[model samples]
Target: MTMGTAGLETQPSATTYELGDLVAQAWSGKVHVPHFQRDFRWTTKDVLRLFDSIVKGYPIGNLLLWVRRTPERSFTLGSLRIDAPAYEEAFWVVDGQQRITSLANALHPEGHLHDPFAVYYDLAERKFISQPKTREPQHVALPILFDLKRLLAWFRTEGEAVLHLFDEADRVATALRQYKVPAYLVRQDDLDVLTDIFDRMNNYGKRLNRAEIFSALYAGPEDGAEERLNLSRIADRLASRTGFGTIDTDTILASILARRGPDPARDIRNEFTSAGRRTAPEFENEDQDTAYAEGEEALVRAISFLQNEAGVPHLSLLAYRALLVVLTRFFAHFPAPEANTLRLLRRLYWRVAVSGPAVFKGSFTQVSRVLCARIRKGDEHGSVRGLMDTMAEAPRSLPTVERFRTNEAAAKIILSAWWSLRPRSLMTGEPYDAQDLSTLLGDQKTAATAAHVIFPRGLTAQQQLYAGNRIFLPTATDPVSEIPVMLMRQPIDLDDRTWDAVLASHVMNREATGLLADGDREGFLHIRQELIAGQLSDFLDRMAEWDYEDTPSLETLDFDNLDELEGGDDHSL
Candidate 1:
C-alpha cells in the first residue's frame, strides 16, 4: 500500500484559477470538500490575514485537488451549508480547505454574518476587519466588495461620505477579482494515495492534531459508508448527553487506548492490526467498532463519576484530562467498583488535581502506559489500589492560581472548588445553570469562558486577570463590562437576607459585598480572596483523606458491616 508518485490515474497539472471563479465553482458545487478534510478552523483574524496576503499579492499556498466524480451530500464549509448535487469530474479538495472555505464564504453574499466570516475591507487603513457593525465610510463589506453591482451601490451610499477612499476600494476590489491561487489537479482513482498526500502535507505543516490524523485515515462516506466512527461526533454526542461539556477527541482517544492496551501512542492506523500488538489483534483486526463503542461507554461512565462523585461538574473544571483517561480504563474494566474503592478513587482524583499528573513520573505516553497498566479486567479493588498507591501523600495546600485559565491545571482546580459552592446569581437566589455553564465553557481553551470580571471597566491589567477577580456568573448574557459595580443594573434593592444569601452563593461574605457596594474594589477583592482560599482549603482537605481501612477485596468485606463503612458517603458527593 506504499503510495508512490507513479500509479495515478491522471498526471499532475498545476494551474491557477481566478479567485472569483473558484468562489463561484465552490458555490455551484463544482468542487467537493472531502470528509477527511479538517473543519473550517481559521479564526476571523486568520481569515483576514489570508485576505491581506492576497491584497498584497503574496503567494498563499497552492491547493491540491483530486479530480473525480463526487456524490452529492449536505455539508458545511465554515458556517455555510451546501445541499450539493452529484457532479462528474468534481475536484475533491485534498489540501487547503481552510483557505477555500474562508474565501468562498467571505466573498459570497449569502454567507452568514453571524459567524466570524463577515469580513470587511477597510480602504483607509488598508486592512481587513471582522464584522464591522459601524457603517464606516471607509469600510466596504467583503460580500459587496466582490460583487460589481453591490460594490457600486455601496459606493453610492457609505462611499459617498468618503470620496477619497474610492480609489483604494477599487484597487482592493480589482485585487480580489484578479487574485489567483496556484492549484495542482490530479485525477487519481485510489483514495489511499490521496490520503497519503494529504497526511504528509498537513502533518509536515503541523496543522492537524494527532486525533485528527487518526480520524482522517478512516474518514469515509465519500462512496457511502453506513456510519463514521468520527471522534468529533463521539465527543459531541457525549457533550449533548451530559452537561459536563465537550471533551477533546485527543483525550477521548487516550481513553480508547487505555481500554485496548497500555500504550496510547501506538499508531492508530494499525490500531486493530498486527503491527499494533505483539499478539494477534482481537476479532482479527476488525475490532474498531467494538473498541470505540466500549471506549465511548466507559468514557460516559467516567464522566458521570467525575460529575456525580467528585464534584467536578464540567470538563473545563477537570484539572487534568489524563485523570479521565485513567478513570475510563478503570470503569471500562470494572463498571461498578465497591463503594470504598469508589471513595478511594475520588480521593486520588483530588490529589492529582492539587499536585498534578506529576504523581506519575514519565513522558505523557509513559505516564499513560503506567496508569493504564494498573487496571485489571475483573479485579476492582486491586485496580483501585494500584491507582491509590500512586498518591503517596496528599498536597498540604490548595493549588495556587496566579492567573485564571480554563484549561490550565491550577485554574481548573480552583474553578472546581468554587463550583462546589454552587455560585448563585446576585440578582437571583437560584444556583447557576449547569447547561449555561457547559455552553459557555464548551468551546474555550483559553482563559475561563464561564468566568467574568466582577469589577467593571476600572481595574488595572494585573487586577483584571487576577484569579481572585474572576467569577463564574453563567446566567448573565451580557456581562457588566461597561458599567461601574455599584451602578450596575442588577437589582440593589433586595432585602438584606436575600443579599446575604446571594453573597454566600458567589463565594463572597457580607463584608465583601458591603465593600463592593461602598466602591472599595481593593477591599472587596481581598475579602473575597480570603473567603475563597478558606473554602478551597476545606474542600481539598475533605477529598484528600486516604480512608484506606477497607477489606482486602470486594468479596472479603463482611456483608453486615458494609452499610456502616459506606453510610457516611451517603452514596458520594
Candidate 2:
C-alpha cells in the first residue's frame, strides 16, 4: 500500500515487511536510504554473521524511515542500481542502511565480483563463505538459493550428491521467504522533528560518531541533497590530493576544528555561528562554506608538509594522526613559515614519529592539546621551540625491522623511511610515485597493500613469518619469488647499469642476488634486512636532528647588512 504523510502529531506507523520484498522495493525505487546514514561499512564477516543470525532466528534490528515526497532520480545501494519516478510519498530510510544495502546487494544477481556482498552457501557444510573463483555443484550462490525458479533449476543440474540436500535447501529458502523486518514509517511534517528523532535515537547510547552527528545536523532539506558538509568527503579530497588514503572523518573534523581552535572535541553542532565557539582571528565570523574551504586549505598545507618536507609519503605511514592534527593547526596559523622554523618543525615531526607514543610525556591526548596550544598566531618561532622542547623531553625509541606489521606505528615509520630511499617499480625501473602508490593501494586502511612478506613452502612457519623476509617493492608479482627468475638468464634488452639500478632500488646488491640465485632465500633476506636496518637508523637520526641547537628563525635574524658585510673588497663597513 502507498502510505502518505498523515496524523503528523501521532506516533509513527509500524509494519512488518518480507525480506525479499524489501530488497525488491529498494531495487524498484519505492524505498530509498537517505544520505545522512553511514555508508556500507559491513565487512564480509559482518554480512556472514547477519545471514547466520537470520538463519538461526535471531533479530537484527528495526528499520526506521520517513514517508515523504521524493523526486525522480537515480541512486545506488552498493552495486545495485535503481531508477525511481517521482512519487508524492516514498519511504525515505533514516536508519538501518547498512543492513538494507547489504541484503539488497548481496541478494541481487548483479552484485559485482569482490564486493562484500558476493556470498555463497556451501550445501555440504551448510554454511556461508565468500564466493570462490571456481564454482562447484555443492556451492549455491545466495541469489540463486533465494529464488524459487533458480533453486529448482539448480537441483536438476546437480548430481545425486546434491540431491540429498533438497530438504535443507527448501528449508533455507523458506526461512528467507518467511523472515520479516519490523519497520516504522514516520509521518512527521517538520524536518526538525525527523532530525530530532535521529539525534535522540543515535544519542541514546552514542550510537553514531561525532562526524556522523555533525553531518546529520547539517544535512540539507528533506527534498534537497544528502550530507551537504560531509567530513568523510573532505577526507576523501585530502586523501586524493596528496595520495594519502583515508584522512578519516574524525581527523578531518578535527582538522577543521583545529583551524577554528585547539579544542577538537568542541561542540561541532554550533561550530560556525555560535559566539561561544573559539575560532582563529582571520577565520572569525564565517559561514560553514568559508570554514570548510579555509579549513580544507589548512589541511592540504599540513598534508603537503608531511608528504613533501617530513618524508612521510602516505597517510597510513604517518605514526600518529594526533601529530597531523597539531601540524594542521601550525600550518593554518603560518601558511609559509620562516625557513628555519619550518626546518625545526620538520625535525620535531621526525622526533615524535621515531619516538612513537613514548614521545608524549603525558597521555597522547594531553600532549596533543599541549602541542596545539603552542601554535598560536604571530608566534611561529615560539611554537617551534615549544614543540621541540616538549617532544625532546620525552625519551626516544628508534624503529626496528623485527615484528614488522602494517598497522603498527613503528612499522609505519620503517616503511616511510624505506620509501625515503625511493623504492622503484621493478617492472618500469621508475620511482614509485605517491599518486601511483595511492592508486595501487586505493583507500586500503593498512600497509599490507604496499608491503609484502613472501613465504615459500621451503621455509618453516617461524622462518616464513620473519620480518627479514619482508619487501617494500611495488610490483604485480612478488619480488622475492620473481627476482631470481628474472636474473637467471641474460637480459635481452637492458644493460648492466639499468639492472644494477633496479636491484639498488629494492635495496638488494648483486651479492644478495647471488644468494637468491643459489636458492639461499634466508641469506638474501639477511643481506637486504641488514642494509635496511642501517639505512632506516641513519634516516631517522638525520631527520630527528637531535644534535642541532635551536636558534632564532631565519626571518628573526638581522639580515640588514646592506650587502657590505660579505663583500671582501668593500671598505665601507
Top TM-score prediction, candidate number: 1
Model 2's number of clashes is 0
Please report, as a residue range, the 10-residue window in candidate 1 with the lowest summed lDDT.
480-489
Predict model 1's lDDT versus the native. 0.75
For each candidate, what TM-score against the reference? Answer: 0.84, 0.84
lDDT by candidate, in order shown: 0.75, 0.76
Tens-place lDDT per residue, model 1, 280-388, is: 4322454666777878888999999998889888877777777888888888878877778778888878877776656566655665677777776677877777777
The superposed Cα distance between candidate 2 and the true structure at residue 274, in angstroms, equals 1.0
Which segments of model 2 are wrong by more than 4 Å? 1-9, 111-114, 122-125, 138-140, 149-165, 203-207, 222-229, 275-282, 424-431, 454-467, 477-480, 484-530, 557-573
Shift in Å, residue 387, candidate 1: 1.2
lDDT, candidate 2, equals 0.76
Q: Look at candidate 1 and tell me the lDDT of residue 48.
A: 86
